[model samples]
Target: MSAPGEKAASELPQRLWLNGRVLEGRKDFERALENASEQERPVLEFGLRWCSDEPEMVLHTSGSTGRPKEIRAKKICMAASARMTVRRLGLRAGDTALLCLPMDYIAGQMVVVRSMLAGLRLVARRPSRRPFEDLARAPDFAALVPLQVLSTLEHEAERSLLAATREVLIGGAAVDRALAARLASFPNRLWSSYGMTETLSHIALRPLSGPRAGVWYEPLEGVRVSSSPRGTLAVSAPAVGVSLIETNDLVVFEPGSDRFRVLGRTDNVIDSGGIKVPAEALEELIGTVLESPFAIAPLPDPELGNSVAIVVEGTPDLPLPDFRALLRGAGLSPYWKPRSAVFVERLPRTRTGKLDRTALREAARSAPGRFRRAL
Candidate 1:
């Protein structure tokens, strides 16, 4: 594979499908950008960047767990990442791929790159909860965040449009049990992606629907997975110029197989007294009892060192005691049970739509009076 900047502009994709129009070459792309609407500008701007003479592009981390930062990635590595996805998903040339994510993000960038490289037509849309609102036809493939998928499933029309898409990739956040259950019957192929900006997009995919659907995430071709000393995931994908990228996400492998299951972030764990609890695992159990959007957070405790608390979005429908009782009845161990609850109008999220744990912790600590004791 050619190094970054080594490949000339002539080697890049010459055709682009912006919205409903076809743009060819640098002149066509530049013309469209000059006359582009606010919604269309991001796509066009990124298109211009991709076609630039620069060898590297600036990308941002999602900042779900920490502060967001910029990282420079080789264009050649990105192209290799795009090709891996195209081959793994069987995306054919002339097929349509939807671009509904923020162009500044890696997911959106990869969609455009994949379309360009594979000769697939690109369909750009404004990023919104209802991405399929103005769609006139189904796309051959589409990429969406978990929140968008959940929103689409709520409405009949949008849900049908999503189901008609030949392939769908869901990422940016974990897919909860309730949402996964609803997707089990979809006729089309739906996958939950596991990756970050550092990996270009996703190095692994877990099928959300079909007979192949399961809890484990299977690494894509040219990708290898291993566990760190701390049990976190480590990846090595030479195809994307990644020799090894260690992650803070805790994972468990399938014994002898390369397949793995993400348990939760090691930093998100609550060390209460001498016992350690994974916040995500606790949240998954809590989700079965409470259907609302909520997160398991750790609160300071003098005796236990740290105590588990539930941060719920919007107003709690039931009384604090009643909510605690419901969780207790759900067969939770003493360690997993939340000692208190906090209610906010909306949970804090990063720009990429991931739970902002750092901000969430600040919220829980800033207002002690707001906490309602579970007892």
Candidate 2:
């Protein structure tokens, strides 16, 4: 419980709303702690710093781009993001929102922050076998990742829950053509947002509706976007904490517009026989050809410093010659295409549902003769 004087009206209480019933955070925490302790040690153990931190959120990068670094976003930034969202979506003070993502991440944290700031009721649920089962009634707003949306869409009742929401914010990873196509059929307002933990969540939102169903990054009032020498995206927003966050994300600016298309990460670039190859670009190419979830990465090579390899989760039996021909059809340079293709039952992912590059690299190395021949 917050100290008597410490409790502010703005402070989000634990038991805000659960289905139709309201549960208090402190009482719920005590019960949950007891229940969890009986079965095992705490699923999440936090430090004193986290408990006492004035900021509502402290998010860390997944280290996919580089080493995982801690980011401290003041509650003010969260409030600012909420305020922008409120204006953009025309949400009212008494509306409701359902939260499914983990609070440890920005997506979930923002829901709590927005609920507090807007004086809106928040419905909380433990991510379950069927997450929507916990929702007492339909909510006015909610945020979901691609995975959750796909999973919920597979079930009639779950899909009903999704359809009931007035607005749905989707992020965390790229939404493919298949998912996008399905979402297009729904009448609900689905927004594909772009942001990172450093940005205190999304600063740009594109409608996932008819005609406007493509990438559009409209910077918030306090935010700015620019490019670097390497054609990478750079973000400047007071709400982002840093003056300028130079990202490794590759982007191409539209000729007459501020919107840009995110190509992929600059760090994923590979050198094949003296040719510089962007692995992300190759992934896009392969995805276009194969129409499947695939990733292209660099394999250590003595001759070229780094050679290209392809990993696919589908159809291991697909012949290498046919796959090569697909790349050729796509007009990709020979060196930019994978030297070897390895089929895995499924690509391993992290807890946060991101590709585990370290695991992928190790998997590539362990494949017989693949890494050696690349070298």
Candidate 3:
């Protein structure tokens, strides 16, 4: 067994199907590669190398949970993942697939690989805030982030593309309640992928729209699921060559099945008066009302040890009592309802666009009154 980045270049694929046309012969591809933009060059180079006898590839995590880490993604694992996607999505040779995500990440890389394996026509587009913009044939399949979906649905012209798409995979972040509601009737088949860079992409998928709309994430074929002592989720998928990648994500598995519903992350747990409140879960619930960035966090308190609080972007327009009323109206317990609300000009986010909860907590702690109480 050769290690990753060590396999000697042996047989290369006959042709590269790209941008609605098949590039025959290596010379044609070399010319296309030379013309690739700086942003697209690296992944295109990677795709070329991956087509060789190389057994593995290196991919980086998104750092949404914490810090980004480099890990090896086995080429064999990627092929398996591609096969699973093709089978599950009903993709066939000559199908049109769109690639609008950054080629640096696994999500983007897999799009390229899937096109090759499934013999689909790959249409490459630079990743952007609105991936559906400009002139291009409607894609039979597409993959996107939740943020992109949110932005796309806001525009009638852009959203029609989603409706025309046969299947669209949404990942990279949890879908908030507001977005999920819009996805419920979204004409296309929408799926929420669950996995990380280490797993080569997703080991499980949950339907976000249509007849199968539900909370459970059904693991991919040949993937096993279990729980750690701390109640976090663990994955064992041979397709990805990962024996067990223990994750900080907390989930509730079905009584005796592999399907599970992701609750939140262990690190994001807010223990308020013995009741475990998943901040992300609460945030999703509150997302139905608040449009701007906001987060649910714990505030220091003497009696309960920790109290529920919310930090929203800009001046809080909704009255404090109304906010609580919304939570209560949604069946949130008194303990789950936020006791205090804080407003910030902007909710801090990490370089990767992840919510900087730690920073927001500090800001709320230091200047309690400035943004606290009512608007």
Candidate 4:
């Protein structure tokens, strides 16, 4: 077998079937780029690089936790990653794989790569909340963000199309409790992907429906996982060229089993008084009750060191006292309850649509008048 990152040119796929157009070989792919539309250019440009003699491809991080940075990913490793997913999902040649995510990101880029390697037909669509709008037929497989999934579920036509899709992978952000509960009854196969740019997409997947549906994520075959001293996840999957990646995500393993459940990110932990609370965990719990967009952030406290605050998008729906009562009703401890609520025009989010907790915390500290405390 060829070593990782060293696949021979002859072994690579020679043709790309993109959006009903067949472009064979590097020369043909390059020729079509001149007349490609704005939406088609990103795919063709990335395809151009993939067809080149370069061993690695340039990609960028989502910057959900911090700053987004560029990284060079090995093509051989990407091929390996594609193969793992294709094999696990039972994707066959000539199957249609939907590409509705932005090509600039790994999740979107991997869809194209997976199509090329597996000989699957690539169905290109602009990234949007309504990705399934006006679709004549459902794709055989697809990768979608949580927002897209939510939007599709709201409309009858789109929801039907989504139900008809053979398999679907939801990623790019955490699926809120409400959305997960709705997806639990979905007729088709649905999975939530757990990974980042460094892993070149998802290293683990949790089924959202069927008998396998649960909180724990099962790592892909050939991937090894362990909990770090800080209770974060550490991964080693050489098949994808990842020797070891120490992630900031806090996780708890299933006793001796490799399966694990992500609690939250350690960096997003809120230290209130002497107790430490995971912001994501609090937000997930709050999501079950709150219907609006909100984030749990740490506010500077006089004695408790840091106190939890709810930053909500748009105007406040319920009064401050009622919101506090709701939290208490949801089983939140006194320390876990938000000391106050802040109303913003919009909640801060990363470019990839993830909650920007660092930004939200800074905004809360910089502005005091925005916070309305419950008497």
**Cα displacement (Å) at residue 218, model 1:** 0.8
Better of 2 and 3 by TM-score: 3
lDDT string for model 3 (27-145, tens) is: 56567787777545665676666755556677887766566789876677777788888888899988888888877778888888888778888878777768888735469999988
Task: Output the worst ten-in-a-row residue range by lDDT, candidate 3.
Answer: 5-14
Best by lDDT: 4
TM-score of each: 0.93, 0.80, 0.86, 0.93
Candidate 4 global TM-score: 0.93
The candidate with the higher lDDT, 2 or 4, is: 4
Give model 2 RMSD, 1 decimal.
Answer: 5.1
Provide the lDDT at 316 for model 3.
52
Ranking by lDDT: 4, 1, 3, 2
lDDT of 3: 0.77
Give one digit per residue, the lDDT tens place, for model 4 in 163-262.
Answer: 9998999999998778889988888899999999899999999989888888989999889999899889999999777999999999999887999999
Greater lDDT among 3 and 4 belongs to: 4
What lDDT would each prediction earn against the true structure? 0.84, 0.66, 0.77, 0.85
Give me the runs in candidate 4 sitting further than 4 Å from their true place.
Answer: 1-6, 317-332, 366-375
Worst 10 residues of 1 by lDDT: 315-324
